[model samples]
Target chain A: MMRAVILAAPSVDALDNPALSALLGLIVITLIMTLGVMFATWYERKAVARMQQRLGPMRVGPWGLLQPIADTLKLVSKEGVRPASADRIAWDLSLAAIFVPAFLVLVAIPFTADWFVSPMDLSLLYILAVGGLSFIGFLLAGWGSDNKYALLGGMRAAAQLISYEIPMILSMLAVVMVVGSADVYRIILYQDVVPLIVWQPLAFIIFLTATIAELERQPFDIPTGESEVAGGVFIEYSGIRWSLFQLTGYVNMYAYSLLGAFVFLGGWEWPFGTDIGWGYQLLLTMVKMALFIVFFLWVRTSFPRLRVDQLMSYAWKVLLPFALAQIFLNGLVLVYDLPDVVLLATSGGGALALCWLVYSVVRVKPRQPLRMVGNVPATAPGSVSG
Target chain B: MPFEALLENYLAVFLATIVGTILVATALIGTRILAPYSKDRAKVTSYECGMVPIGRTRAQIHVRYYLFAILFLIFDVEAIFLFPWAVNVAQASHSAFWAMVLFIGILAAGLGYAWRKGVLQWNR
Candidate 1:
């Protein structure tokens, strides 16, 4: 009777050994990702400097490869200044709250076959959901600091993230519709034969644009536009607290690159059906990620900052509609037997055309330059418009 | 299970204990290295708009932020539950899907209720 009871209860040993291993593996991956973030900062500085025709950080170690390490040591040694009005507990907790979840998201990313920490069926959704948790940290930092600038920055980030999230998720849904699974591995496997980018090109474009905004990267970096807000939400943070935030940003950039590779660029899958070994596959994945990172840096150096309203409008009005249409088109393609290339090309072309039409209609006409609000005309003090 | 099996089963606990001890030691050392011992009137002054604060800086915030936080918690919990329900849907009968649809419908109704009540409204 006891044996039957034990059997019915589902033995704890039945939980599977691989599950435990996966959890440990995920922790290791997260650690590696954290290191990746530190390196990416160095990479970005060097890359951006190269674009500007200048030598970046070449003082610390060979070619300044250890610049991030030096930066981290300096930040660690510096004192963390807390505003007297600040909620100390909340401020301290906010750093952990932000950094931990960003680390946790790495677990859902697969590096190779049999390499994922937790093989979740809903890995993609899980990553998306957890990624939103960073906003809470931002809010906490803003509110906890009791500084108006920080508060405004935090609020802007929250609004920006929440707004971009809709289009981002919708774009991902287009991939899901094509692949019929939210599992990261499955999505990659589906991409093996033909990458989802081919079928969901519109979704790919929308996803890339929204993700750039989500990461608060160039063109969409109005939140941290130093000239306007004086460093935004991070103006108050100093020393290690500021370093942690910066670290989180770099890690998020890497995470986004990995996500792009998985969703659109056939993660760990070599082009032209070359069955590369696992080591080579990892190298390929890194190369693909580097290319995406370069693209990010390139855009940062190339484009001017987007106005807040324009950024929001692009996400909501432009990306969201096209993402929805792409999903619908994907559904139709799935239901019928059509030439895959033709279907994809037509859907992509249609989305682009629609976007162009909307763009033309909504394109802002250049207006007369505004007179400075406080500038008094030299000829007449009352003539504000002169 | 025998005592040996029980001991084997608890291997993870042993590993965690070792890791936890190392982490605690490192944290203590880090705190010692980083903490500043100096304190003075100027150092302790309340920071308020780059001026000495006139009144207590720790005033109570708006109650609506708390209300919204509570609402966020409720919805977050609902989302967490949906995960397991979603994973188990394939194992269940067709009724499971209908049941989920009904459940989600009710949740949506709650969201709508909150929206109508202005609980979800953020603007001051």
Candidate 2:
């Protein structure tokens, strides 16, 4: 009985009591997300500023470490002006609807082998499902604002989000098929010998594109494109509400980066194996996550915003078919009991094909202007009226 | 039990939601306390790049968005069916693979038809 108790204790999680674990996990994760988002804001500004050849926020604590805090303080103290005609309930609910899920996804993320708010069997699915709900908040914000720009931005945001979600889920489906598990922990463990990126480069590429689109970052940021919509859905928000939305965006960046790290980059498993202590596990996870974040920031500073039409077309036409093809290939291999090298060959070929497709599309006649240029008669054939 | 473990895991998520709500509520209240507020009619009116607003805020959207939404609904459901098949594909037989191939083939066929119809074309 004593030996049995010892073995059982090992099976139980560190914080075995559910209620206490929930409370403690919530507090720790909340604090981390808040501080991490603040740091991310500072990091992004500094990174983007450097890329543009300018010093960013040098006045605050050494190297402008305190800039995000100062910005937060200013935003918090500024008046939150709600438009008189805005829908009360929708506008109010949008804030929490967007903000909470950004924080809630942390509950299932395994920071290390043993360190997690909860070790879930279906963590990947849970995160995807929870993350998808935030688009509803965007719709509500857009409809409730009683502003045309907000409504336009909201519709684009909703449409863009739903479109990109398909490719993201499909890419994840490819990974799940290869690993035979939807549990993120097991998926990471499967990569102990070899990371999935080698076997499913196509899926990795698809996931990367979908991640950028879903985040609504540069190139895919039509919903909030400053030049076009002038702050889009966020146009009518001010003060704390505005800051919260911005904060949620950063938090989501962190969340998706972490997800990418765990799924594609092998999380805390590869290179060092599972025997490493918690400190190394934590280090590995953070470093991989930082790689993703930097790539995101780099992409943000580099790419021009894609046209809405191009964005939607690419997701549905190009990415979706490729993603589905990846699943089919994986199924074919798995059922045939083929060696792993076959996966690399097939997926690598698909990646090349995808690249060629993009290159060929670009090489073709430049995309027609949405309408004929200035001085075209409104009634002229093939001319569009705004 | 498996069910018990599942409940324990999700209980944390539930608590996280509640805690998140409290945290956001506190921030809202804190902002209310810290921020200065004096309402003005012009300030409350909808923003129109400094112009007095013109017409209805809720205008009719294009029909294409609704059409794309219907397309999305169909594809999303297809994706849902694919997930379980994906998880068990390794142990499953060749017949299962062929079944999925047929299912996805039909999806691709529909997508191709949409493309041919110019439903995927945004400008149209």
Top candidate (lDDT): 2
On residues B6-60, what C-alpha lDDT tens digit does candidate 2 reach at each position? 7876988888899888877998899999999998988998987677788899989
Candidate 2 regions with alpha-carbon error over 4 angstroms: A1-14, A363-386, B1-3
TM-score of the second chain for every model: 0.67, 0.91
Per-candidate TM-scores read 0.74, 0.92
lDDT of 1 by residue, A1-386 (tens): 64465466645533455435544664576468657878889989999999999999999999999999888777777766677768877776677667766766776677876566555657788788878778878878877887666776776677677667766776776677566677888888777677777777777778788789989998888777787666777877777678778877888888888899888998886363436767777787888888789999999999898777666556545565565456445544554444677668866796678668657755655654555657853342333210
DockQ of each two-chain model: 0.11, 0.79
Q: Evaluate all candidate structures by whole-model CA lDDT and list the values in order.
A: 0.69, 0.89
Poorly placed runs, candidate 1 (over 4 Å): A1-20, A270-274, A354-386, B1-32, B35-37, B40-49, B52-124
DockQ of 1: 0.11
lDDT by residue for model 2 (A287-371), tens: 9999999999899888788888999999998999999889889888889999999999999999999999888766535445455
